[model samples]
Target chain A: MVSLQAAVESAAPVSRLHERASFDPADFPVPGGREEEWRFTPLRRLRRLHADGPLDAGKAGVEADAGPEITVVAAEHGDPRLGTAFVPADRVSARAFASFREATIVTIPGGVAAERPVVIRVRGEDAGQAAAGHVLVEAGANSSAVVVLEHAGSATYADNVEFLVGDGARLDVVSVQDWARDAVHLSHHHAVLGKDATFTHMAVTLGGDLVRLAPSVRYAGPGGNAELRGIYFADSGQHLEHRLFVDHARPDCRSRVTYKGALRGDGAHTVWIGDVVIRPEATGTDTYEANRNLVLTDGARADSVPNLEILTGEVVRAGHASASGRLEDEHLFYLTARGIPVEEARRLIIRGFFAELIGQIAADQVRAKVTAAIEAELDAMARAEGGAR
Target chain B: MSTLEIRGLHVSVAAQAGESREILRGVDLTVTAGQTHAIMGPNGSGKSTLAYSIAGHPKYRVTSGSVTLDGRDVLAMSVDERARAGLFLAMQYPVEVPGVTVSNFLRTAVTAVRGEAPKLREFVREMNGAMAALSIDPSFAQRNLNEGFSGGEKKRHEILQLQMLNPKIAILDETDSGLDIDALKVVSAGINAYRQSPDHGVLLITHYTRILRYVRPDFVHVFVGGRIVAEGGPELADELEASGYERFLAMEGAPA
Candidate 1:
């Protein structure tokens, strides 16, 4: 007997009342790399994803499984919540939204607390191929759950993810972009929070030739809170970018964003852009954002920009900070003065710089994996320098 | 018996990118083992520069000087090399090292100096004893190294390190600048305890003679315009406190 889930996923498109997102791929114009959002990105290296390139069906595959209380369904076009939070904000995301065949919807019933996290694994098995994907996550009122979107393997992929958090619910979404060395990834994630909801979104970007992720948030009612935290490391010839936006539309809402990155080796680059908008009606809103980057080697580059737009002065607190610098001379001096060698001192400082954020990962295995990845990046740079010498 | 001998020492510091200014001029001093020397001077007289130059601080450049520790060229050593070569400097403004606990820093320093990691039990026992002797609270072991420590606490921590590392020569740069009487007595006791070693030497650089009353240097040198203008015994320190640097400043036609 064929499984019920497989039949549903392969069935004809589901009928709904909402208008379908244009799948023409030509609906979005090609970005010229001169736009403010695209200025720091290298458009010529995108492998033609910006110019209506075909998304190979077998390039990247998705396999999602979840706890017993959550229902997983294959949603077709015209599903209202499919594109509700996740509107294609850019050309690549628009192309991804337009070309995807079916979207996956994962729903958690009201007040049902899952004992384990919902794990969605997306693995790329082919090189020089591009694929598009979409996932919609909904948590009903008073429920609490964690959804982990784990990406690994090869292929150039573009995808859009959405989160609809219900009132009084708590939801944590961790999206890890751990692609292969030759792969390229561009993803957009949007979360719409309900009244009195608590939402947390974390992005851990470690691998990929060029990975650009944009995660945004919007609140439906007051008393909502959202936190966006991310960590990334770019090695030689790697480009990693994370751009986040938090829109405070409801009064008494709160939001926070913190992203830290380290770069080493020649042509290793990272970009973090945090934009927070507090509307005039968003009185009593409290928001803060901070971005810090540590450039380990000589040729690495990091660009951090934190923008805050407050339409009214009635907010509780709003502030933003961005800092990028190499290893501090004083810190090195302090360490070396005690007899630790220069290389060991640097390793210790970098470890300490990332310890705060790494400790925040609730998952033990992921935290260990991230720490190991950082160590590996450092060791790779050391090996490269040794080889050059 | 070893000695740290400095003769005709001259040093310059870069005021900016291109310009250099001389801070130490024609100073001569000898610190033999089992002796303590106090170099007292007014602000901006280059007392701290001498301490840093001997410690090989990158900010201070020795233009024409010879610093020899037991016939080894101290001037040719890097900061860490100088530290490993049995020379230590207790800075006035100890840098704050975040995310490094005091216990870890001390253990690492000791390991580096001894060229091997110490046994955990022995290291912990020694650390506890040193902390107790310096009157450091037990919680300080877990705190980040000098990150948020008070002035007195920093001085005590420095002495704690001096005791733990046990360098052949120790230079206390303005160690008594920001301390209460009780703290001064405690720190002085720690230094005196280290001075009990027959092969250890102490160099105290201070603006006030207040700490000298507790540590009691064997020799006192009055510094003016980056050089020692007057050298005498402990009586010189008493005279400087009683009469101030007016007589010495006027001896060189310098402003007091």
Candidate 2:
């Protein structure tokens, strides 16, 4: 019963109107604490990383682990492939784009199937210092690969990750933000899918003082498919946010988005924004988005917004849904009345809530690690509350 | 020999517009091992309240009562404690848990009740045998518990648990309400099998006497106006079926 991580599968989406895209840091000025994107964030807690601060990583670094069929290149600024598939939408993304002296470029050879995942480990060694990073992953035509961008340690950091999926390629990227409790990290992910290509992105954010991510996808040709999935847990005094967008500008494209989150303790806050758009020329486009949140204790807040805009009447399907609530008393009672302890019952329900998304993870070690981390969070909450709740 | 003793149980529920309505008023009943007591009543006559109160449902406030099992105060125990104390209630309406599969739920309940986890192979073997006996598909073991299940499936699953948990006393609340003839027979067989064990007792609550034809009760009690009005042997069920509770409804002073 402790390892039922593989059995649960299940959600449905929310949206807020937004229109801001730029590559120049000047074009996107510092958030004055009142903008829609920065309102939920505590500006003072950012440690002035949003201002004219240091961008050199100093001790923070990135390391790649891959097989011989793949190439991990370190290219300097003005690398032609660095920003070809990415556009900085916010000031943090723009600053991260302008500040990095070098970027990590990962290329998977065409028609090559990797036996193991390409793990890009981003680790920080200092908590008081600020840094920015950039990584671009190119999946060659007919290639199949899984890239894991894992973050750990402590630092004030910002980064931009771009994935260019070539024709008939399949690329799945999992970004896990298991940072130190004192770390503040922000990131943006841009993905472009070619004809008949398949792309998937999963975000796992469990540890950090403040973590925000925006992952967007664009279809570059017809018959492309993209799916976005995320699972996150916020502890006491933590902020986690994810903003997602999927654009269908080509005919015969499909997209799906689902994210689930749980928050416990005082001042625990989480947010999800899903925006999907189907344009006029995009005939036969299909899309749906959903977000669900569970608030385990008092003083925690979760905001979910799902928006779907369709300018063409020729599309097949377009829908969205959002739900944010506390645990159901009936579920707890059902489990407890069957002889399960109340604490164990609560743990099961919370784990089941996130199992739907976590079950989709293909890597066994990564899934086990995520499960262990969440279990630790649940244990901490039980100790703090003394199982009374 | 195990026995469940109930004395002077008074239960109430919250009513609309800031008021309280009594559901079980000074009712008393007892069931010893090897006994099946059938309590038949009309609609809204507090039959379910008796079953729920005995199971420690939070909605049923036990204003004044005492329920004990072999000298232990069952009223002092929480819901799970009651189950661990050898009391079970096969609920008429089982709640649907979205992600917990049937097999996982059954194993968890068995472990909690038994106080030790069973071996995986042994558990699966027992589960498969029980499932086959109940005529349930093996694929149902992976489906979520009671989620998107038919009425018959839910009822059969309840009896399956009744057999699996093997509690000392079981209060079956309307287990045959929505069952077809075949399902009713299967579920009744499951219940009968559970009753075969020594130190096991049953309190079957229902509105009709059709199920009595299959699983005969040892005693029949006429329930009306939140209390038992009459008690007799199994023949009383046949008499009540022939002549409905119309005469019993007109008996002594009853509250609306």
Highest-scoring model, lDDT: 2
Per-residue C-alpha lDDT of model 2 across residues A1-389, encoded as one tens digit per residue: 01112211111111233356678888877788998777877888887777767787545789999999999999898888889886777788888899887799999989998889999999988978788889999999999999999999997898899999999999988899999999999888999999999998999999899998899999899999998999999988899999998878899999999999999889999989887867667889888898999998899999897766666667777788889998888888778878888788888788778777778886777888988988998889889888654
lDDT of 2 at B229: 85
What's model 1's lDDT at A81? 68
The alpha-carbon interface RMSD of model 1 comes to 1.5
How does model 2 score by TM-score?
A: 0.94
Residue-wise C-alpha lDDT for candidate 1, range B1-256, written one tens digit per residue? 8799999999999998899999998889999989999999999989999998998777888999799999999888777877888888898999887667789889988988888999999999999999999999999998888988999999999999999999999999999989999999999999999999999999999999999999989999999889999899999999988999988886553432
Q: Give lDDT tens digits, candidate 1, residues A283-383.
A: 89999999999988888899998767666667888888899999898788767766666676777778777777877775566778888988887787678
Candidate 1 whole-model C-alpha lDDT, 0 to 1: 0.85
Q: Tens digits of per-residue lDDT for model 2 on B1-256?
A: 8999999999999999978999988788999999999999999989999998988888889899899999899999998999989888988899888778889888999999999999999999999999999999999999888999999999989888887888999999999999999999999999888988767999999999999998889999889988888899999999999999988887535642
User: Which 10-residue window of candidate 2 chain B scores lowest in summed lDDT?
Assistant: B247-256
DockQ of each: 0.53, 0.66
